[model samples]
Target: MSQQPAPRQGPIRRIAGDWHVIPGWLPVPDLGVLPVNAFLLAGPEPMLVDTGLAALSDAFVAALAARIDPADLRYIWLSHTDADHIGNLDRILDLAPNARVVTNFLGAGKMQLLGKGDPARLHLLQPGEVFEVGGHRLHQVRPPYYDAPETMGFFDPVDRAYFAADAFGALLPAEAASVDEIAAETLRDGLVGWSSVDAPWLAHMDQPTLGRMLSGLERLAPEHLLSGHLPDARGLAPLTSVIRHAYARGTTDAVPPETIRQIETLLTRS
Candidate 1:
């Protein structure tokens, strides 16, 4: 089956000083809208958090261009090798010939295996190492939950902004510009639901162990929690709170047998 087109346009919203977001809403079957987002670190380094959805390539490029000229982009941070995050990667590389793709070992290998990027333009990152771009130092931190092993998040000490690759994603009943727009219960349910689907291992995690993970983020107290699937969030409490509450007794819910079968069939066809 052909892929569905994502929403064409998403307004660029500023989350904090020099930190801006471009959010795209994509629809999922049986699930509501999922926010597919990319962030911009607008400063001396001028790095892009990730490329937006491929279905909205034109809009994504345009949104990114509006923030800063494609040629001016110095770094393209690949949070992971996931299609949603790396969708417009090549296109952006074409536009920003000077920008290097910053990613870890597995991410670079996946890009080569998938033929999605040029290795010559790749900057391989080491575990626990931080890179200094322009004047800002970006620390590599793994998110608590992710679907891909190559997944990595970035922490900006200057702005206290955390770019959580695929973690904290939630499927919402409707498109929201920010987490504050979502109701308390809806946000909780959506957060747990998406977590269950994206990282089923959560169901097997011990409560205290999970709490420690969630508590770690709480300790950071990021000014903005940037998620690939969630709208702009100002605080980590709202998100971490939901995960803690839902997973306290155990995981949220198990993936349905039918959904697994459907996925297996689709993979076979592909």
Candidate 2:
């Protein structure tokens, strides 16, 4: 069952030049609350990074309208076929008749399988392809970790903002307007904890390979790191450092003893 909380109507906060974000929170079982965010690029040709949660459909659409007229939206950038990310897609499409659904072939196919998205309105992007909307050049970036194979992130050269679909997400003890408000240790634990849940295979990944992937993002030198499940962040070093050390110990196929014990206890009780 979904652990998403009631939609919190929030103001659109500017993260970088012309890049605005609508941030909300979702409860993570036993871990705290995780941010559920969607970005808006206000420019000559406006675009939305991801549609917010279905639970907040009205508020999400209203938030977007507050930033820009729905009729003026030029693109709905689908990060993936994830429900949280695309919950209000059809609603937004109805509002923005001129907007096209920007996604990759796999993403389009998944939407087709789900029988939701309109094929005729899709603007399919090839791997490594850039989507130029007005003054901003959005380069497709696959994050180091993600829950979906078809997940697509983006790097905006104009603003030096990297929209990581689900990477760098964390669970915090409380709702934060910005990542800067989170304590260093809290952020570290949250980042690692959320990664453990969202990307369990991370425990089995080769450290060197993972390090290389993390390094690549470092090279991007993004001024702002935008994560779907993270509050607006201007720094990437802290987040990367946490990931680096957390997985430094290397891969393990065995489940944690604590988890096994809990499962056994539950079975016995039942």
Candidate 3:
């Protein structure tokens, strides 16, 4: 049914040979894993996707050191500007002096406001622009209703991984280390638990925009979707079906109010 291929690298598991989630030793009390699933792009020129946070930097650095030369990090391909996504950005840039910063225009501006991502090293990505890196071609795409205008995600042709920013991301945030467990919790309370807490923006989403977003998502048919906050794949099947239904109903606000009322009732039962 859903792809649960052998844990790619034993208990730890590597989604792609080049990308693996390194577990951290010191997790921030209720903040889940210290470093939220950092992506290690290993090759002649390696890079770190998103650094954890200040609280987790020490352990994160040690983890990075385990499999990398630190200096070998050529660029930090940040997916978004959230703290967990860029917590250790300044420290990492200083550590990996050779590495430049790669993110969309808005993200770069945010980093600059914080006195990070110096202009010379700042790389801005436009939609449809593709670049070559470590034998992989990265194509950028902008998701609708983003927190920032320049919020964009990357699609890698080599590993066929689509870094879909916040789009298709499962959890509201990586507040817990156990992605699988959280995935279960969301279901236990019914599908509404997640949408109620995380998808609040859905109420304001426009029908046309929803159509466009789904259109962009269908293009990737991503095997691996790493979002800004959510990363659990357990909801792959149900979420797909639910999102499809929502899009269809969005066509003209045709989804009757009665249907929504029923959904609210279901939420209460959960």
Candidate 4:
């Protein structure tokens, strides 16, 4: 008898226009699970925020190819240097040879090597920097982090959109494309385990610092929040409440270890 086929592995949503969210889960080996949500901030040339792992590169490439020229992919920005976020660099480079890699001062030099330091395309970003590319302009603020020296988030002045990288976020990948209520419910359900009184990795975050970060995110009041991993495009006050509480109380709610581990296992092939 033939074996049952595996379930399809791919993105969850395909929204249209200047703002689009392509949500997908990316797996990693050894480290843990990570959700990579590839985005296109459309301008003269759309910006590819973070490339999913090499394993999922084709899905992202194909998605963009259908809407825009794969060659027109002009900017590939790094929120941080964590492997899950940066795993698919080689494959992305292969598809968009002209795309410039952007990141803040801390990882700028390293990103140069990662992007092969193509002088014409490699850009080193400074904290509190302003840049215009592909007809879109953005202001940036690089926050000091536990790992990366200058990991920052970008604010699109025109659109009121904030790309917050890994800061001020939550994961609801499976429920995207559904109504805001459904997505918010899914996000809440997933985080219960981590937000439980006894969360292991919740220890990683420093509550005071996280609170400050949350405050910054509120001040921005972005119409859309484009996170680095696993897009939750649907908007809601409750979801924001969870994220705020998580930071304020230093709760883990399982995303750091469990979800990250599961994603890594599925995305990585032995």
Candidate 5:
């Protein structure tokens, strides 16, 4: 079996009002490092967006404790059942006894299958339901591309921030404190490379349909874009533009050959 790389935990930092990011990075061998982030909404009703990596459990729990007591958490928003997103679900649940997991029916079912989350503690949201907490109204958003059908992204009206489950994520050459630290071209290439691997369907998607979805997200005009595998982005335009231009004609040429090779390697390994 191939050895997995150890994930490095980053310091907790506040990205917006009452929004703190607990960041970590997983090296992807030759590709680069992928950011694994979990957000904390430190408000009257404290909520955690997603749990950090299980490999970094000690650091993750410590960073979380530094900001607020785990027992004070009111909600644990499960973006999806993906390991990277929910690695510390059970651990966090044990610590945050009062916190209910916010997810859709499908997500809850997946959790049950994994024997992780408690069904009684799940707060399932129906389609198109607005989750109101701590003076923030969160509207469910379906990202243009995703690896899992259960993925649930959201937009917070109060902070004008959009949490994109796995969309707009990029594999960077190094750990960046913020998106501004990376060069534009490098960021673009990284975004394309990561998306091509994570959501290969993007290359085969209908141009018009995909265009409409991206356009609608752009119309939302979110001031802050939070991604599970990216440093906090300042706005939605840049990320949306990268996806738009990459798939303008539904061709694979936009994706680098090396990225395709990497995908093939991953498939073979799987």
Candidate 6:
């Protein structure tokens, strides 16, 4: 008999040089809010990172248009075929007639299976291929863990920013303009908690292998770490550290009761 709260769009803000974030928040009944974000690279060759939530399609489009003309977009970098990431793919492709959907082979195939995207407009990338756009070279870097197999993260050489797709996402107690606003303890709890639910197989992953992947990202030393479900962050160290420590001995005993409750609530709602 009770109505659920609708997801709301947050103010659009710049993360760095030409990267702007279009943020939205989804309310979790007994838990806190989860941030859902899409990014825009307003440059000579404009590109969009994700399409944001379908529930906020109008607001997302309006927010994007305010920054750059939809038709001016050169590429739509889909992180994966997850609903939140590709919710507005069809709508965006329709609006951006000249734009191409930049994705991997599997990603393109997944789009076909969903009955979304135009084959003629797809720009598929081979593994280890670097995407060049607007004088920027985007090197594909797979995140340590992901809910979708087709997920593809990237690092921008121009801004030293790493877009980690769904990795490093957290469910915070409140909306934050930046990661600096959340307390260290809260961030750790939230990050580990969200990962447990998002990628449940993480607990079964080989410890040494996971550590090596995290180390590799740390060595990349991105100045800015961008995530789909968290506010803008400065570095990957803080996040990588939290994940490394949490899963050092596996996640079975690491997750807190509150996190379990939150996951249960989410399942029941769905």
- Candidate that scores best on lDDT: 6
> Each candidate's lDDT (Cα)?
0.82, 0.81, 0.56, 0.56, 0.85, 0.86
Task: Please give the lDDT score at residue 127 for candidate 3.
Answer: 58
Alpha-carbon TM-score of each model against the true structure: 0.92, 0.90, 0.70, 0.72, 0.92, 0.93
- Least lDDT summed over 10 consecutive residues: which range in candidate 2? 261-270
Clashes of each: 0, 0, 1, 10, 0, 0
How well does candidate 1 score on lDDT at residue 220?
A: 82
Better of 5 and 6 by TM-score: 6
TM-score of 1: 0.92
- What are the clashing pairs of model 1? none
- How would you encode candidate 4's per-residue C-alpha lDDT over 1-270 as one tens digit per residue? 854222122543444336566555532332222345667776687677766555555666676666677677788887766554676666776778888878765676666655533455667776677888765677885431223455666777576676756543334334334335444556654444323312343346677765576566567666666665434443324544665575456554454566455543554431
Which of candidates 2 and 4 is the stronger one according to lDDT?
2
Candidate 5 local Cα displacement, residue 81, angstroms: 0.3
Candidate 5 off by > 4 Å: 1-5, 249-270
Candidate 1, residues 84-133: lDDT per residue as tens digits?
Answer: 78888999999999999999899999999989989999999999999898
lDDT of 1 at 50: 85
Best by TM-score: 6
Candidate 3 vs 6: which has more lDDT:
6
**Which stretches in model 1 have alpha-carbon errors above 4 Å?**
1-6, 252-270
- Residue 114 lDDT in candidate 5: 82
Residue pairs with backbone atoms closer than 3 Å in model 2 (clashes): none
Better by lDDT, candidate 3 or 1: 1
Q: Cα miss at 260, model 6 (Å)?
A: 8.5
